[model samples]
Target: MMDAHKLDCEAAESDCRFIVQSEDEGEAIKLARTHMHEVHGREVGDDELREEYLQVV
Candidate 1:
């Protein structure tokens, strides 16, 4: 079975409550980054996203 990875925006910032989960960490981060850019109008880097947003589950 694939291990699940998660990204919870609420964990990083209380005002933004976005959550994304996927079997692959790369996929989760891609979705989270897109969400941040499209929805929040913030372009976040991959390194920063992985460091701040990604959580292995």
Candidate 2:
């Protein structure tokens, strides 16, 4: 069976910290990362100019 508590924690982390909202954190992380790259010109999500996107969901 799936672990409810684990999923809840992961969901919250993947959503709040990263400003990412999705039914799938894996996909969401990739999306957020990609957006970070295109919009910020930083593939590693480390744009100090926009440090807000410097995190993976």
Candidate 3:
């Protein structure tokens, strides 16, 4: 089994310290995108999440 995929909001250079981890990368990205939009007012996309925030752990 592989480790869960991880994403940290701090990676996007935001002051918000949001972090998400899941076996499903899609889920992580979804949660991150939602958090960014609701809290930070940014509509982040999958490519940007994969490139800027996604981390393999």
Candidate 4:
């Protein structure tokens, strides 16, 4: 997990900022909105976020 976090930390600032959060739900929800609109074409809800955050972390 530390290694993964390190890898993320090494990323270019723009890329890191694009994917990171401060445990901030409001920002995450906005990201989900963008993903749903431009990528998945499905609604993104809290349940999906909980599961994804678990896996990524």
Candidate 5:
């Protein structure tokens, strides 16, 4: 099994209330990217999301 991960939109300095938690890193990144685009109006890459936003929880 994969470790659980968390991604917070606030970590990127936005006021978005979206937070993603999943055992699948790919799902977390995918959701985060969609949220960022739908809510924050930004396009973030996977590497950036993984390095800056994704956290093990």
Candidate 6:
């Protein structure tokens, strides 16, 4: 089976319940980073994103 990862924007206290899932942790981080920047106007760094958003599933 492929690796699974998840990220929930709500965890950051945003009104967005947007949850992103990916077969790779890197992909999940990229998606979450882009979403935060485009939708929430927050540009989060990779380390912070990994620590805060990226969740193994």
Candidate 2, residues 1-57: lDDT per residue as tens digits?
321111122332344433444555455556666655665564653233124332333
* Every model's TM-score: 0.83, 0.41, 0.88, 0.37, 0.88, 0.87
Query: Which ten residues in a row are the worst by lDDT in model 2?
Result: 3-12
Q: What clash count does candidate 4 reach? A: 0
Tens-digit lDDT track for model 6 on 1-57? 876889988999568899999998888889998998999888899899888778888
Residue pairs clashing, model 1: none
**Candidate 6 structure lDDT:** 0.87
lDDT of 5 by residue, 1-57 (tens): 668989988888566677899999899999999999888789999999999899998
lDDT of candidate 1 over 2-40, digit per residue (tens): 778899988766798789999988899899999889988
- Supply the global lDDT for candidate 5: 0.89
Q: Best-fitting candidate, measured by TM-score?
A: 5
Q: For residues 1-57, what per-residue lDDT tens digits would candidate 3 score against the true structure?
A: 977989888877557688899999889989988988998888989999898779989
Clashing pairs in 4: none
Better of 4 and 5 by TM-score: 5
Question: Whole-model lDDT, candidate 2?
Answer: 0.42
lDDT of 4 by residue, 1-57 (tens): 231211121232233333534355555556655655564455656565544441233
- Candidates' RMSD to native: 1.3, 9.2, 1.2, 7.9, 1.4, 1.2
Highest lDDT: which candidate?
A: 5
